[model samples]
Target chain A: MATTTVSPPAPGAAVPGRRRRTPLARREARWAWLFLAPWIVGFLAFQAGPMIASAWLSLTEYDVINPPEYTGLDNYRELMADPQVARSLGNTVYYTALHVPLVMLISLGLALLLKRVGRLQGFFRTVFYLPVMTPAVAVGILFLLLLNTQDGLINRGLALVGIDGPSWTTDPDWVMPGIVLMSLWSLGSTVIIYLAALQNVPRDLYEAASIDGAGAWARFRHVTLPMISGALFFTLVVNTIASLQMFTEVYTMYFGNRQTQTSFNSDAATFYVIHLFQEAFQFLHMGYASAMAWLLFLIIMGITLVQVKLSKRFVYYEGEDQ
Target chain B: MLFVAALVGAAVIFMLPFVWLISASLRPREYVFAPGFLPVPFAPENYAEAWRAVPLVTWLLNSLVVGVAAAAAVTLSSAWVAFGFAYFRFPGRNLLFGLVLATMMLPFAVTMIPTYLIWSELRLTDTQVPLWAGNLFGSAFYIFLLRQFLLSLPREYFEAARMDGASYPQLFWKLAFPLIRPALLVAFVFEFKASWTDLLKPLIYLRDEHLYTLPRGLKVVLDRFGYGGEQQWEVVLAGSVISTVPMIILFFLAQRHFIEGIATGGRKG
Candidate 1:
């Protein structure tokens, strides 16, 4: 876990002189740019250029086939009026709300359990992570089978305990929950993160807490939680962002060319990105879609900023100045 | 004792979908949803049927090529950029690196359509190039990962190589590259898995059925064979298993690297 075996000076450690550079230093700088040329080129082409184009396109109505016409914020106005936009955004927020906390809790619980395992840690970790490695499309299809109303394994399992399972795929009320269940299968990475953080917590702290006559719960609350809060916060933000963009799994299960299966409550799973995809690709409303994308980008940025601000109060980073 | 029992129970629950998938894949059409874990009336013909029903092999091959191209492109390029960040002391370097990391926070939704337009403008849409070509520049996350590894290496090696009159490329190719093979492999396998599982890019860029990757092909398979068309649950499960086995195998082989990479990522955060 201690990866930096021989730590060198930090990447941007201050050089001796501030005003001037040696010839050798200048030569090294030239070589650095040369080394970074590919990424620079890519940043311009794929990221920066596309971002500017997306912003400009958001203000203009230009389908791929049509000449550009300035829309003057009409797309944004329509977005505010569009019921599907609101519905999709609501669905995304709902999914994120349920998915993020559940994932963090389950993953943290699994990590705690793994920390207790003695010899078979690797074996259990592999089993837990196997589902994470499965392709989302495959997960979607597998879950569709598992969550079948009548004969799915999930319902069959529930029957054993005399609890009738809801029709997960077909019922509108249960569709998002089904997606959340599918999402839980891939919490293995989060679990591993928490485990790493848990292992990194100094053992002496727990011992000291016990010696101070603290119980297990107090020891965990006072010693464990604060020590691992950094990792917990990291997963919280990452999982929230990912959950907000839920797409491939939902699309594969409910919407993608499955005309026959469209009778189900597919609208319940129409996430924001899915709606944006339909607007851009399906309906050729590229301008409107770009507006939607910018909206999502703002929402994500705002949420992330809020999370980072909140983390300052909660997350404990060792060796940092208060 | 209770903890271990609970862990085993949770693991079983976590593994239930996979177990049911394999079992359903092996069952006859009539028993596709049988309650028991075992495939009582075993039937392996579902694999054969799934293969015949769609171009599963072609999709698998396309995925392999795309995955390899993407992995190689991103791994090399990100490593090169990371080496620059790690080894050099240049003005504006920190600002540039910060810019690279900022790109990670930009959701793909914002850039998806515009990037598609860029590809289409280049007249490269509907080909496999759009899928892997973007990786030629490199990814921010991989660049960050490899940079951490590069930063940890002893600088004396590079300085000594420089003193011996080795050119920067020679130093990187002959020394830095070999030293950071572990991190590079981690980057490669991670990108490969990403490309293999990627459905959106293929769905957006590729229109031809013959050019489909596994995930994209599986989507179509779901439509034509699964709940959408024939309701052939066994056949669909067989396809799911086929698409998943390679990744499972990859995980088992590179299990250590995968876990280590994730752990390092957490620490970095």
Candidate 2:
């Protein structure tokens, strides 16, 4: 690891006259601002600008065609009472809660399995991550057929085992679960991430634990889990954020076609972002939708804060003792 | 022995859905759901038929153009900014860089409605501009990626070049860009994938029939071909195959770079 100690401005790495004096320091600062002009400008316009506007827009009633009227927290107040907002947020929370655990387990398991394989590791790793590389829309459409209750391969496989497969996309109760399954199908990238983290875990730690009469589960618990907690935290945070705003799969499977908007199971797959999308774009309820976005934003921020606090308690960084 | 068997078995089962997808695409429309999971009575005509269902060729070309443009924008601009973050120190530099990292956690949905309004106000909505314009600005993830890669390079090279009177811009272009090509490629590929797979942005912004990307066109195909449950499912699957195969090919072509990016992203800050 290169010592990231700021290193005293790199000793005039980009220009001569190596000193930390005012004029030289000002020159470096000017150069940095010049070099970073594009990102800084774009960040202001695209990122910070949208954030501010979204906040203000949340307080007003505006359709695209008409000017915004000050609604004075009506949007947020309505959000408190709206059943759909509750449903969408509930669905999203259920998904994030379920998907994060499933992804962590599956990716960690696959990473562990891959670590043991020798010659065929590359082949198996490629196969596992292939779905992750595939577009989500394509994956969703394919799963729609694969999880079809009647002729789908999943149902067929279940039938051969003497079990009946429930409706995946149709059953309201099973809809989000089915989407969760679809989302987890592309666990390859997360698996690869875990695999990298696993590689960094010192082999001697495992050996030491084994020699100390720790069984396989005990070694994994004490040595492996502690070592990989940082990676686990990383994946958890990322997956939580993505799952909170999951739209592609849900939109692709249930509401891909506008003709199906009036279908029975429309609300079944109504995720937070998808609801926000329909409200903002389809109905042009930009202010209401902006309010929903902010509400979802607050929920995500809260969850992330809680996770960080909890991770601080449990995550064992290898070098923190130093 | 048990572990090996389980791993291989798991791989096969994990791949079953995709294998089934390809088989379903190749099977004759009538036999697409015929219990057997093989591409029997193969009909490649489904691809041709799906192609004709919409202006798929145009959409494909549009997707390619948008993807390449967005990838270039994301790569170059991100590398430029990362050079600044990696090499220089200024007042509030840490704070500004922190802001860049902070943006990564923001859901695009939070900014989507307002950005759309901004674009609409500029009369740029209902076009493909909304899909790729923001990407021209460096994204936080790619900026962080390139910055990490840049910091990993020995600083002495820039110092040597500076002794020869190379300007910061020249150092960035001539030295830093070439040195960090792999990370740049990673950002390029990521942006390309983002633009390629994007649905919501295109769905909201691209209302014209001819402006659809492959993903959006696949939806159009679904509407036209897979309207009722009884309609042809093979064609939709065929469209999906078309949408997916390029990414698979790209993955195979640059597997090392792609894997390295994923691994490095996990390892670094």
Candidate 3:
């Protein structure tokens, strides 16, 4: 169905406006509100209220112990001047740029392979998805072992091919790539998503295209790609947003316990959320961190909006009037 | 034949890290970095050592408690809310549902600090309460998921129940709840996984080592054994495997639901 999207549909679809209210409808409305009470309370306490608080906190200099002092626009201005902010944002963007496309491509490829597999489809899917089940902490630790410069499995594998591998965790240049490699292990979920979408593509379309003398690649490009473009666009946006907020894995591996490490290039791995986390928790720069959070919120919103705008051109919904 | 070969090859690559993890966990401290895939000098004592080196059992128990609490809370509440949106054709329902969907996109970073502050203000920071308590309000994603499932159910069933003079609560607890068990289970399992693998919340709120969940405890284990103290990589790998086993078991047990739920997610996307 065209409605098979993970992203929420546009807000006002098929909504009846200003209908004459029956007594039964009013009763149902009251009951609906009652049923929604818990969420409303939660939304107020956890989300909406906190968002307002965070916005105000961004304009103050509170460090939990002291009373918040007013400093309008100061934190925002500091964010503009902060070099670490720039570095962290750049690192996050770089990582996202590297990660999103690579993951989409690899997962799509795996999904295609899985689709071609006969009886062993489920078996292969399970094998691929096992890593996705692993906790971020475990994944991070496991990757540290795998990416070790000297005796790690990955480097050893490279050595088997007569190619020297860089010290993934230690070297500045290779650190982000190492994290990206680690992230790629968990692309199974994406693969599963693509597989589901791929399976949903009508066989008749492919048959028709083939009947028109279209080759395999041409059939795929014409029939399969457009049919699954909604899913692709969805994953692209979701993965990009998730990549921007890459914290737990990077933190666990590189920046979590820096006091223990003598020499690891953590700078390359210092993503934006990591920097915000450090400020809020480590340095207790509550005001500054709040500003960073708002900035990230704005960036994510802007990007998602741009994606939705762009998807109008690329994503084909079935049965939509062209 | 070539396609099968290609699938097998890719599957091997995908499975290699796990194979190596299992092998490394079973190896001696000195042999952890060994090149061979087989644990020739088999050292199952690493599990014992890892168990002793960290409060692995306690962390697992803590993880179970938090995961269950979070999962149960989110599942029940989200289902309740979803039922409201699904069964009730009320004014402003679409608007409210739209708002719920919008919250799914709001990054957790915006609320992280203030939410922490809210807990600390209530003097509930450092307790396990902060880990799962907020879930009592129902999460946006689960609400949407359950709502979709609820929407797919035939309205005739609910109407039939209502015509039998069933109250709203009866309509929910007796009719909708039982009918939506599959969706509820999906939401529960998904949330359980999320809570089990969550590191950030525990890292922020938890101070006492005894209170740490598996992921947070694993982080401590990594710091102690893997990086700092003794640099015993085997012990860390063993702990990692220990922490991962529950999830792997859950996956196998709920394989159908897990696959179906994910596919549903893909379909919805």
Scored by lDDT, the top model is: 1
Question: Weakest 10 consecutive residues, lDDT, candidate 2 chain A?
Answer: A1-10
The TM-scores, one per candidate, come to 0.96, 0.96, 0.95
iRMSD per prediction, in order: 3.0, 2.0, 3.8
Quote fnat for model 2. Answer: 0.73
Sorted on lDDT, best first, the list reads: 1, 3, 2
After superposition, candidate 2 runs with Cα above 4 Å error: A1-26, A256-258, B228-230
Note the Cα lDDT for every prediction shown: 0.90, 0.85, 0.89
C-alpha DockQ of every model: 0.68, 0.68, 0.63
Better of 2 and 3 by lDDT: 3
TM-score, predicted candidate 2 vs. hidden true structure? 0.96
Clash number by candidate, in order: 0, 0, 6
* B1-269 per-residue lDDT for model 3 (tens digits): 88788888888888899999999889898898888899869999999988887888999999999999999999999988888777665557778888998998899999998999999999999999999999999888888888888777777676677668787889889888998898899998999999999999999999999999999999988887877666898889998999999999999988887888888777766
Chain B TM-score, all predictions listed: 0.98, 0.96, 0.97
Candidate 2 per-residue lDDT, tens place, A1-322, comes to: 3246347455434455645556655676689888888888888888888999999999999997788999999999999999999998899889888999999998899999999998888999999989988888898888888888898888899899999999987888888888888888888888998888888999999888888999999998999888888889888888888889888877877775666666555887888898888898888999999999999889889999999999998888877744
Native-referenced DockQ of model 2: 0.68
Strongest candidate by TM-score: 1
